[model samples]
Target: FLICLFGLLSHYSDISDMSVYYSISVFSILGMAIIIIYVCISISISIDERYPDEFMNQDQEMYFPIHITDD
Candidate 1:
């Protein structure tokens, strides 16, 4: 994230005005944040799908610890 910010800031410093540079930084940060959030959610969903039974067992254990001993 820092690398991207610094690279963009440096690249824009020579060609654009300060307002344009600042706006770019602001929009870039927001875009990066949104992309990061989307990636995280997608990864989590993939994990859930990949381990559906494991997650279901974990959830059941979390809510009903005593039920596990019946088996």
Candidate 2:
């Protein structure tokens, strides 16, 4: 939806010079909003995973698998 709106506005701007400036402003704002939202959501998820409850079963920690050779 955002991509389609952006493209429509871009085409509209090309035909109508008057709306070109405003279209650019709107486009930039939309782009920034999307980026801000993405960053916030990712950070929140990471924070949730990092701070776990003591009672909750935790995932096993990663360890290097040892290989043994029998002579």
Candidate 3:
């Protein structure tokens, strides 16, 4: 995250066109937001699993695995 942030910041001053900078900034912000959100959710789930009683209701169940037979 810091890597991407730094990379974007370093290119900030070089953008002579406002439109280009605006687009880049928008995409960068969105990408960072998604990455952060995913990481946070995954961490939360891990912690919740560690304390099962605190998050048992949040657990998810998977259906049976698909098996293929020869034709």
Candidate 4:
């Protein structure tokens, strides 16, 4: 929906200032990145929950396959 709106506005309209469009694009990209990160974390957590650490060595903690954040 956002893509379609951006495309239509870019193609059909004569907007002098592109700042709004650029801002919208940046926001959309950020939104997508956040959503992807959330999905990845959620999937990893679900997998860990489904298959507990008992399968691995007792000395090790639960394995998180995807680490997106720096912390």
lDDT of 4 by residue, 1-71 (tens): 78776666666546744765786788789989999999999988898897565457444444555334466
Q: Can you write out model 2's per-residue Cα lDDT over 1-62, one digit (the tens) per residue?
A: 55676577666534675575576678778889999999999987887787453124343222
Q: Which residue pairs collide, candidate 1?
A: none
The clash count for each model shown is 0, 0, 0, 0
RMSD of each: 5.2, 9.6, 11.5, 10.0
Error of 3 at 43 (Å): 0.7
What does candidate 4 score in Cα RMSD to the true structure? Answer: 10.0
**lDDT, each prediction:** 0.74, 0.64, 0.65, 0.71
Q: Between candidates 3 and 4, which one is better according to TM-score?
A: 4
Clashing pairs in 2: none
In angstroms, give how far residue 61 of model 1 lies from its true place.
13
Runs with alpha carbons beyond 4 Å of true place in candidate 1: 1-16, 55-71
Q: After superposition, how far is residue 12 of candidate 3 from its true place, in Å?
A: 18
TM-score (all chains, Cα) for each model:
0.53, 0.50, 0.50, 0.53
Off by over 4 Å in 3: 1-16, 54-71
- Per-residue lDDT of model 1, residues 1-71, tens digit only: 65675576667545667765676778878989999999999999998887656656887866776554455
